[model samples]
Target: MSRFEEELKRDKFVCSECSRCKKIVWPPSNYCNKCLNETTWREISRKGKLVEYSYNKGECFGIVEFESQIRIVGTVKGSERPDVGQIMNLEKCDYDGDEIFIFSSTVQRNGSQNS
Candidate 1:
């Protein structure tokens, strides 16, 4: 398995860091977006909040922001409807034979939209 795939399967989520600037590059890149230096893999929080989202039919996708730094874009699924600033947890999911990533939110736990 490729390093990216292996990291996803083992750690759930990851972001790359620029060797020189030490800043994280989301969506995993070959090099830093700012400094153009080589990047290394780093594990991130599995939990975060939905900063923005939209869905077509039942499939949902959005940008989730971590507590401190970094944000990632990916699919999400949950019992209650998704909305901005809702807490969610990232997880590995399956789409046909491919390994995909998704988020399961616990928004209702905070006392809103229990559906």
Candidate 2:
């Protein structure tokens, strides 16, 4: 498995950052997509913002954006409905042939419960 997949299996969210240009490499790679330099792995922040969302069979799913760059689709876990653009925290992650991400909202950065 790739480093990214391995990290996911351990419930750690990580991405490759270019050592030369310091750019975050999405679709995590060993080389920078911009500068073609070798990359080092780094943990991504747990906090993200909800970008968009949908429901399937009453399960909430949404696209969450992190570091103003990386965007990932994950299942949103909560009893109440989630608001768009609300702050979200990565709750769980794993890999099993495919990646799995789970998120839950705590509070907005501005201290509001929802946004």
lDDT of 2: 0.92
Question: Candidate 2 on 44-110: residue-level lDDT in tens?
Answer: 9989999999999999999999999899999999878899998899999999999999999876548
TM-score computed on alpha carbons, candidate 1: 0.69
Best by lDDT: 2
What is the TM-score of each predicted model, taking all chains together? 0.69, 0.89
Q: Residue 53 of model 1: what lDDT?
A: 86
Q: Model 1: runs farther than 4 Å from truth?
A: 67-70, 93-99, 108-115
lDDT of 1 by residue, 1-115 (tens): 6556666666456678888998788656879999999999877778887898888777788888874567767788765568788777886633333547688876556677644
The per-model lDDT (C-alpha) reads 0.73, 0.92
Mark the regions of model 2 whose C-alpha exceeds 4 Å error after superposition: 108-115
